[model samples]
Target: MLLHTFLAPLALASVAGPAQQDHYGWIHLFDGKTLEGWTEKGGPYDGDADWSVENGVILGREAEGARGGLLYTEQLFGDFEFECDVKINAPFDSGIFVRMLPQKRGAQFTLDDRPGGELFGIYSNGYLFHQSGGDAAWRSGEWCHTRVRCVGHPMHLMGWIDGKLVVDYQVPEGMDEAFTPEGRIGIQVHGGMNDPEDAAVRFKNLRARRLPPMAGENFTVDESGMMTLTAVGEASGWQPLFNGVNLDGWVPNGGSGPMTAEAFEAAGYRARNGVIEALHSGTAGEIRTARTNYRNFQLRMDFQLTKLANSGVYLRSVDDGTNPSFNGTEVQILDDFNWEAASGSKLAPYQFTGGLYGAVAPSKSALRPIGEWNTYLITCVGSRMNCALNGTLLWDVDTATLEPKGGPPFAERAKAGFIGMQRHGSAAESESEVGASFRNLFIRELPEMGPSAR
Candidate 1:
């Protein structure tokens, strides 16, 4: 069974005044006067529901003898914060759906504002959570401010009615495989014989803001605009690889394998105060994971570099003393702004930060400043490799189809091997120091499935 909590309302103000205006980074789903950016479609019923904009509010009613349907946003959202004011007539049934597609079952925040209805309850296949005493939280035939926040692959959902916390639910582990990570937001007018012709639900001041992947209760944005996870949520399936104090599961490349924190430090890396610092000692080497056979996984980490630094993260690399950049794959990491000036040579398109080194370049540059921390979210499954840097997707491509400029095709590279981080030797005297610092290293192994499976 899933767990949920109904907490006392916070002393937050009602959704009025400044709340009606658009904020930075927020997308207004409704234009207040027109039905633009939205589409009416049958959600679970056979015919469309009557939908229109009336006096800056979206009104939903049953169409003639037809059943009710959904009004969905044109754009899709994966993780987001959504807000709107809702007014429902008595005995009407409606809901706000997230990750919803037309005619498909989805997670819903119930607004069944009638006797025996479960207001603010979560309904998917059935009531995932049933909120009792719903009438205490509902204001019949009047506008009630509602907000929903959802995040993660198997989403954690929360809802508030009139500034009071009504539901906080995490999708159960067993249901992880069934959840859709992204879909359109929908407003449903449920079909039922009891729904009178005058019964309707109205929504106004609709807006939403997209959130980063895996962002939830444990995620935060620092003052410098860097996203950090204080701890991985249990439902997120992410395991911390770096314990913030040791290298117990890591090894120096070309050595006898995994070592203790002290032993690993002696091999040119320092682990202290939650950061793993690679000490560049004029000779290029790497630190690799002791477990050498990760075939499909999602790897996330935060890295900071000294000025003009050059480094790379190796995926599925062989242990035959061959260059991992050629044997497997490397996601290039460099001081993008200063690398060319310091090296006195131009960089290939595939040699910049977030690129699949030697094969495919990033779609755009998303690196933070050299001294500030930047994040990498790398997903590898079958022939596809996708990378996101600092919350921006850089590339999502199939390695099998890529032809490298000089080396063998990426399709021939090892499919299972060690995960490593490269230290690209020393920098010139005229250049700034060259080293990389890393933290929050986490990985979650994904089920072995091809791109079509996704």
Candidate 2:
């Protein structure tokens, strides 16, 4: 099906798509009439009732101080897509929240696209999140299209001048490290609560939609000639998480396998076609790193899976019985389309792609399709986990579920371990073996959980 087929049922579709609308996982928020599920914060609900409509335009007047904020919505969202129209009154400021609690200093989201759209300040535990390009463009009174895509825990916020994609930002790494994946979303009318003056702003054609798992064909981009794609200060530099070849510093696990570094070359697992392809797709072994075990690092790789194939990249995995889900943790690499049919629909989020096996599940869905390559970036520390497909949030498990719940949650039992890949058995093999392949393996070590591990 087309993108429309995946996003048509979204609640507030603009009647612009197929039979319904091309809205994905979106839940209807504003009914375009009342604020039934809305609330107030920073200032009053209608800090300035002057926000009423003038014919068809939302007009904003002056309010006291700078506390003209609106913290509405009875819901909060994780990795998803949101879009709306905004018209500012000259030097206006606004905010779109995700993973927030809605208060003056409670995880505020900045949508300021104009010059100085957002100011950077340590709110929770992150630094340099609201780094605006260069405070320059801002119209006194004109409708501006706004779109925000939250993927991989970082929100890719962008502003449009009329119809042009101007401002763009990737939320500084670790910005949402403290914010929960679920919370109430709010809209701000920035001002002082005790004094509301000139804090007037109007919002019309305001709408939002949540998207679903798109094909890999929908995400590849060339950033070539895109000068704005450069990173700003304080942002984490791009780390090479994979080398695009056979597992060099990795070793295969289970049954005392003899597949060592030299063995990889003997089997023609090493290559140079821009990516490493495992020649032995019929084998039941894996290549594991002999160097280090990561706890709070990120892993990204592009892969292609077979029709009835099953596999996963195990994180902090150990050799207890060879089942990563029960041994350590597995980021499910199965096709979301057939995974349910092969195993069951009840697989926990942590057991799927970007999940912590049976411990945690991603807060959103961000997987691509077969033959085409998809990206998987998983971050783990202690029992906490976060994974993203491409740039979308697919899994964000917590510590609560990653505990030693005995048979219920096994991965939690191992604190620190090795990272490995798994090849599982299907009906064709009662031995439950894996025949999947992987290339471009890389890793980065983070500071240990405490001084004890250091």
| lDDT score, candidate 2, position 403 | 60
Worst 10-residue lDDT window for candidate 2 reads: 1-10
Question: Scored by CA lDDT, what does every candidate get?
Answer: 0.74, 0.47
Model 2 per-residue lDDT tens digits across residues 187-261 = 665554332344445665554443322211122222110001123211333333344443554555643443554
Clashing pairs in 1: none
Candidate 1 matches the true fold with a TM-score of 0.53
Q: What lDDT tens digits, residue by residue, belong to model 1 across residues 1-454?
A: 0011113221222222221223133566777888777877534432477888888899998877746888887767777778899999878989899987654556999988776888989988888998875568789899999999888767789999898888999988778667677778889788754577688999998987665444545456432223455565535566777777778788877776566666765566777767778775533378888889988988888787776567889999977888888888899987788656545567888888988988889899978554556678898998888999867789888889998875578878899988888877553321333378787687878877633212
Cα RMSDs of all predictions?
Answer: 13.4, 12.5
